[model samples]
Target: MKLDFDGIRLQAPFYDETHREWRDSVVRPFIDKEIVPHIEKWEKDGDIPLEVYQRAGEVGLFQTGYSEAYGGVTDGVDIFHALITGEELARPGAGGVAAALTVHSIALPPVINFGSEEMKKKVAPGVIKGTHHISLAITEPSGGSDVGNLKTTAKKDGDHFIINGSKTFITGGLKANWFTTAIRTGGEGIGGISLILIPADAKGVSRSSVGPKQGWICSDTATIYFENVRVPADQIIGKENEGFKIIVNNFNNERIGMAAGAVAYSRVCFEEAASWAKVRKTFGQPLSKHQVIRHKFAEMLRKINSTQAYMDICGWHIKNGTPNAADIAMLKVQATKTMEFCAREAMQIMGGISYVRECKTERIYREVRVMAIGGGSEEIMRDLACRQMEL
Candidate 1:
């Protein structure tokens, strides 16, 4: 729906005529017809049906920035196309549902970028069509951000690798049919890491939902346990022990996408609060009449606009093929902080209504922490940015 206030928008340099058309003709309609109507139900149910993903795929939502060989548009699809989709999806203000539908964006890249032709042939079509759900499994029970310190081990046997480890906080874990998994095949260090594509139904593979948490309630967050799970050696992505770089390469896009989502979510909060202020009376006067309430909206927009600008700049860099990883990290940090601020202010402005599950602002309020922590934590993002700057 129209989630923006007064239809006001700061110019996004990254988007063009094609992007606008896609937003109007593709993204917007898909969300209205498929997502907005069912979001609350999915949230309460704690899982979206697989058919939603299939439908999203049919609408070309999952294939926008991918290759034509794998069901995506071959030409003119770039980072901006992906960002437009991200913004539209986020406008509905359901982070968990977004996560559930787009987890393949993270999971499939490793295959597209590094997997064998056979692997891409087998995996990409199913994922693009939404017949198969895939997820990136990196974080473990022992460590969340410390990729090098992860304890999951993969031992090679005849034509296969037996994996023994667990991944926690896995998005789409419960229903994912494939997982681009991180494992240690060598000594303990960053150099020891490897990426493997594991079949979710492989023997010894089991998963249980992480149950409920602070946010993303509709996303099927889970703990995936692999006890000597055997994956075909051919499923190995990229060079052995060089998986860390592949994962690292995926981060910039992931973080930027997350940042874009956060910014849109922030806008939703701002719009919800501003609309509420017009009708919400305090002391026999509309809340918007109060200078204090007016200032909150101003402050929220300030952050939202600046964050959107920086996010667009990051997207530009990515499109130009000169993406700076650290900059993307900082943008993610900025966007999440902005989202957090707007969610709080929106909640404050909306008062009691913001605390309940019936409103968009309230759902976004609970989802703020996940935006900051997932993809990459704010603390980690800052540190990563500084290190990338060689500070």
Candidate 2:
């Protein structure tokens, strides 16, 4: 707790004085005053307050990388600045709240990349201002990890496309004003997919909560059903039958984000364990004084520092638009391994206290599983890396 980010030095020329200052001045204050105190309540209640989004918008937290015309920052996108925000927000307490608040990141890219200017004007501004919420629908209850096999269909009918299928585990589904959806638009396989910007209020579209999850307790998850919901042809994003590639690219970025979150959680574990070791007595001295305990702490630090290095390099390549797929895949694997190891070490170091519900380390341990499973599983990442090598 006393140490600054002394470990993960932002020595890259990419991050300048302004980026560090923004983190210190703007983001830190919001976390201290608004988020830290109420986060526990949000986790317990199963969702954050609705006002959190508008409050974030008022302070410009949700609009950093977007266009000025759409109520976001007018300057060019700051990749490092985004990294700082992602790391800080991930550490701010509730995983669910952070995910829901930033769900717009996943929902906006395709629209900005391919939607008509009129479509951007219609949705981006309201979403940026926090007046509207948007969610991305891709994973279905039938099978999430297998995207090509999705059964959701959108049949063309003159001016409209009638969509039918269900998407489950949709973040912000219950509250979004719009949804960036993936639908089967052609014959079969990945080539048949298309993206659409569907309004939440469209007829025949219904949503309900997807019950409880093990963690990310503060973010809302839902099952979204579209039974012949009519989406206009104009709503299609980019060219038809090109959605699969878009979704794949999107997942690569999301996996990196999830990797960053995992590292942040590992840091949380280390900090919690460090504090407990200092105060807790074992035998005749503090836990930190014991050689065995010190070694465990060292192991945890090694995993965390190593994972952070790989993730930082991956972020660097991504910011530069470099094809470092191997790094991205490896980072996810390394970071998740670090998280899993650190969570276990933390629990061991804290003994009974780590097992209790009141401790954050315990919560983080439970959260790590979903991180590995979602975005893409660890086994799947290994397979992807092998294929990238053409092995």
Candidate 3:
């Protein structure tokens, strides 16, 4: 029983030949050649080079689920293609690699969906081509999940808006060419917020690194500051005070991608543990021969399979234009919890060997907390789900 990477994936009817060709020909080869080989060095250096993004762009990795007018491949693409791309990216077990390369996934959608035609034309092509980078700046130093209370402000001043305040824990912040930011434009709460695109080179816009983090090491995290930054009023992503709806919509898609990645990471943990259990001797024989160790594998598989099914159902809802935020939120919680459990059990099975760097399980073990907290914390997700349930 030799379990390879693809062998661990649970087969589902949702995927077709397009998804398989994407996995087998495009993403898997790219990960093996580009990401898997250099992940250790990139993780150690705390950054992935921009060239990798350029290459990813060249191969249409960033084109999925996007409009063809903006260099995206949306003719036959759906949510499943995006999910497959995300899952294969996680196969290397370095979440940061996926995080850094795909930061635009969260940043660009608002611009595409609601921005002016000129704004979309200006921003989308370069980013999709991987020649430019963008970051979503919503989480502030004062708050994380509480977007309604964000303190960042952009005051109207003639033809331009004067922006102030700061954002923290922003993925891809350090290298971003533009920030799709949330600012208070009205009064208070969700109604006050609006999304704007701020050029990183704009005067009064500055950033500093927020490392060394516990995990996602290869992805550069940052605290970005805006001191009386000025931008054209037209830079706003949507109508003033209506950005909350855009943000919520973005969150649903982001959570779906995160859920897919989390489940894939869990599978990676299971694979590493199973491989180790077969070879590493204990007592009088291999660890897999022991009942206790065998049970661990069974438990990991049970969780992984269940989470994969939940993710697929959520993806289907999204594809059919009937996404339930509550289910997506719960699915994210389910996937991250599964990743957490699998990483722990894999560590226990591998013993001290799992504690060292360069080991996928060890790296994933460090990343569990971020996965649980980043998209929306487990606490917040549960609360959101319950609110949607009206219970």
**Highest lDDT: which candidate?**
3
Candidate 2: which pairs clash?
none
Error of 2 at 367 (Å): 0.9
Q: What would the per-residue lDDT of candidate 2 be over residues 1-391, giving only the tens digit for each residue?
A: 3622334332455667877886788777777777888988888899888788878777787777788877888485565666677677767535676687888888887787688899999999888878788888999988877788899999999999999999988999999888899899997889999999899999999999989999889889889999999988999998899998888787767778777778877877888888899999989899989999999878888887787777777777887788476668778888888888988998998999999877888888888887788777888888889988999
Candidate 2: which stretches are off by over 4 Å? 1-14, 74-76
State the RMSD for candidate 2. Answer: 1.9
The TM-scores, one per candidate, come to: 0.97, 0.95, 0.99
| Local distance difference test values of all predictions, in order | 0.89, 0.82, 0.93
Model 1, 1-391: lDDT tens digits are 3436426467865678998899999989999999999988888888898898889888888887777898867598889888877888888898988898889889998999899999998899999998888999999999888998889999999999999999999999999888999999889889999999999999999999988787788888999999989888888999999999999889988999998899888888988887889988989999999999989988998898899889888898899899999899999999999999999999999998888887898888888888899988999999998897889
Q: Write the per-residue lDDT of candidate 3 for residues 1-391, one digit (tens) a residue.
A: 4565678778999999999999889988888888888988898799999999999998889999779999999988999999998999999999999999889999999999999999999999999999999999999999888989999999999999999999999999999999999999999999999999999999999999986999999999999999999999999999999998999999999999999999999999999998899999989899999999999988988999999999999999999999999999999999999999999999999999999886899999999999999989999999999999999
Of candidates 2 and 1, the better by lDDT: 1
TM-score of model 2 vs. true structure: 0.95
Q: How does candidate 3 fare on TM-score?
A: 0.99
Give lDDT for model 2.
0.82
